[model samples]
Target: MRASVSTGQDLGMPAIYLHLLAELLNTIGVDEQDLLLRVGLDPARLQSTNLRVSQPQASEFVTRAIIESGEPGLGILLARELKLPLHGALGTAVMSSRTLGDAMELVTRYLTLRVPHLKVSKRENGSLAWYLVSCGIDLGPLQGFIMDAMLFGCVSMGAQLTGSVVDGLRILRRGPEPAYFQRFRARIPVPVEFGATENALVIPLARLSLPVRFTDDQLAASSRAQCEEALQQLTEDAGFACRVRRVIETSYPFPPKLARVAGTLFVSDRTLKRRLHEEDASFQQLVDRVRLERAADLLRNTAMNLSQIADALGYADAANFTRAFKRWTGTSPSQYRNTWKAAGVGKKTAERVPVAG
Candidate 1:
């Protein structure tokens, strides 16, 4: 695998790490390839650094391994083999930071540099709560393919930093269906609630002062500096595409102009365009992506008409928006909206139309 320095140590894909360890175990006579096979992962992938194992595949592999090995800590053991503490540099850096607010900011800011399909936000409304908001990077709705562990991991990262239990945790699903809430309670002592408006962790802001064991100023500074370097380094990596996507997504409701994004990144428009091209993208591609995402949101969450959606995306007219939408998704705007509506989404219709042209 062409591992970039900007990968931020986490490897992003834990399943790949476990597969590598399984390969190592095979060398030592542990034939865990069968276990990996049982979980639908290719043992050949273990040798390829370029391929990644899916989360569900990894979870099943470990679960089966634990059953066969009669070892309850198999998951933790594989995690250790992956050097998770070091790979979890963002979490470790937050734990080493001087203050809770700074730590939260670091995690929120550099997460995408490490993880995929995650958007984090911190709000201090009387108390501090971090929202692990998911944008549809997985090409599905937030709840469609979200990993169950992510909810726990989000809270666990914060609780580990503070060395204090979380006050509460929330999940923004419309219905309560999972029967494993008790299992979650065993892993996370905090109260967990589903059917909330959004997935978030409600932690007390004052707990930010709680002492952590690994508060190394040098490590914190080094990690923060490395994170910034990694981001700057991404200007030359595949993740440069993600940065362009991010800029475009944030600039939505109105299509972001090239100069504005260039200014935001402190790079010239020409330089930004050149870099994006090198990363196999262009400003127009990102804009189209932003429009598609917004169009999906409007179709699923609002009652916006096609004309209004087109106008919001900076299209001259509804016909143009429909053409662009068809180009991006191979479906007409009205067809897309009707499909989602038939799926029973957007129970509450928006009074105003979305202009995600």
Candidate 2:
């Protein structure tokens, strides 16, 4: 399978981040599963680190999560829970970086791999270095929540990378501080300044040389290579074909029709076909790709029988599903499940296993 999607437009937020937000909602006594379903998102899809939820869907879900949880500071809470490894390859690259400066540079270059809407730019002045963060899209109500998660997440990450909070670090926010910030202010390691010209993380120039706690030169090189490849794939996947795939991936009733997928993307059938062809993709190919992925996941993780799995993937019957599975993977669905089970891999482990294209 391809390591990442190839380029045209912004693909969307990584599903893992949304999954983390859902977990936060659960901790706050909200029915996160229901909230996701109501927003037309599949809870299962969020489990895949490699998948991305479309921007509109992700925006709606986050908006509702805030309203339902009645917590505007959920972003800060979310940041506190962001362990380094949850960031995927970027996390690995950062963790294994030689110095805080190197890690921050990696983040500035490849943050789009994780958060499509946000970008970080570096500016240096006498004695101080500022990492200014700005959003590429109009986040509106989500602006505060995202900024809180991002800037605080950086603070959290920095503390994790270095054994201590680097001296003289601070956070800058553009608007007046929100009322809820007081609840988190005590836990935040760095001082925050409000009513600033831009949102940024400020640190002394000398701190940039602070060595990362877990730096490994070999791991750093390999992971940075992975980040570069992922970045390329992400940029390549931004085209019309990718947008259509996003629709199909999240659509209800499994294996959505071409017209439905096209309509969802606001293009007619002919135009959709032409655009996808321009990207060297086809409607059925995209649908098959999604089906194959879902099929593999269901086979490995669920005890659902072939018949049930067939129905789930919109196949006519078990035989058809089995044949399709064999065609896609060179093995039948039952054999696939048995092989995975025989390996003693659990559902959680299976879920983390990236499917080859």
Candidate 3:
């Protein structure tokens, strides 16, 4: 099977993430050298946080690590190890913010430095605050692992910032409830709602102003300066393909409209078009890429059939999904699955109706 949707371009993720995964493996008494190699990453090189690897490399690494370690809740475990200073200057800035609200503002502003492939923002209504998140690329089967880690990381980082649980916080996760969701709840005592409209952390508005225990105006100012510069550099370094891909990834009900995606990104449709042009990409290209990758992942990872897979991928019908799949891979969906099954590898997919979340 293809390792990931990405073409092994883009500095995919900071080396720290892969390294942390390695540590997670170590803790579980599993050897990680082969897992890293499966994705063209060297175990030794991951020791330096400055190194970069392609998005596919990181995604494949995570998938393989999860399979090998038999830990579906790897994301939650990884989040626990990401304490302060682990996020670099972004952590410094977050640590010194005046209050939980301020820290969150800084986090939404600078989180890209830690994980550029995602966009998370904070929105407030009358009595609730939402830490809304959207992916910048298709995560395929790894979506659960990635989203779990990110939401759980937010909880962990929140506690570090405020020196408290930052009470009255709950998680709103997209997709069905995986059995592993409880791993996150175990680490951070918070309510989690699955099959939600979006991926977010819902908080009581009252908790937003809780004081950050170690706020320092001077440190925050300096760290913010560094974070701003780093954000600019990383923005260009990471490229916009993943950013656009993320829009496709998080759009619920399969594909989202281009104008809607632009609006979500806080840009005019025309501007969104122009920016994608500069990246030598387009909305349709990203949509197809995400859809195709997700289709393959579903076939390989889930027991969903062609029709069910088609529905999940936003196809109007199985025939349409079959045509698209053949065009994308040179073979039909059944052909692809049969070929893999014949090879005696991949997920042990069986016929079963998916349970309602």
Ranking by TM-score: 2, 3, 1
lDDT of 1 by residue, 1-357 (tens): 332222222113423455555755565466786766554454543443323333333334555554566544333233323322533556567767876667668867886554454567877777655555654333222122233434545555556666655445444433564553443345545566777666665666776555665688999888888778765654444355555554454332357678866654446899888989998789988787667776776667667788887777788999998887787777788887787678675575433333344
Number of colliding residue pairs in each model: 4, 10, 5
Predictions in order: lDDT: 0.57, 0.84, 0.74
Candidate 2: where are CA atoms >4 Å away?
A: 1-8, 250-253, 256-274, 277-280, 300-304, 326-357
lDDT of 3: 0.74
Measured by TM-score, the strongest candidate is 2
Q: Each model's TM-score? A: 0.46, 0.85, 0.63
Q: After best superposition, candidate 2 residue 236: deviation in angstroms?
A: 0.8
- C-alpha RMSD of candidate 2: 5.1
Q: Which ten residues in a row have the lowest lDDT in candidate 2?
A: 1-10
Candidate scoring better on lDDT of 2 and 3:
2
Cα TM-score of candidate 1: 0.46
Model 3 weakest 10-residue run by lDDT: 348-357
lDDT per residue (tens digit) for residues 1-357 in model 2: 212112214467778888999998999999999998787677877877788877666777889999989998988999988889989999999999999999999999999898776889999999999999987666556667778888899988998999887889999999888898899899888899999999999989999999999999999999999999998998888787787788678766577789866655556899999988898899999998889888887887778988999998998999999887788777777777888889777545445333435
Off by over 4 Å in 1: 1-32, 35-88, 139-147, 167-175, 239-357
lDDT tens readout by residue for model 3, 12-78 = 5667777888988988987887666555455655665554555555666788888888888888888
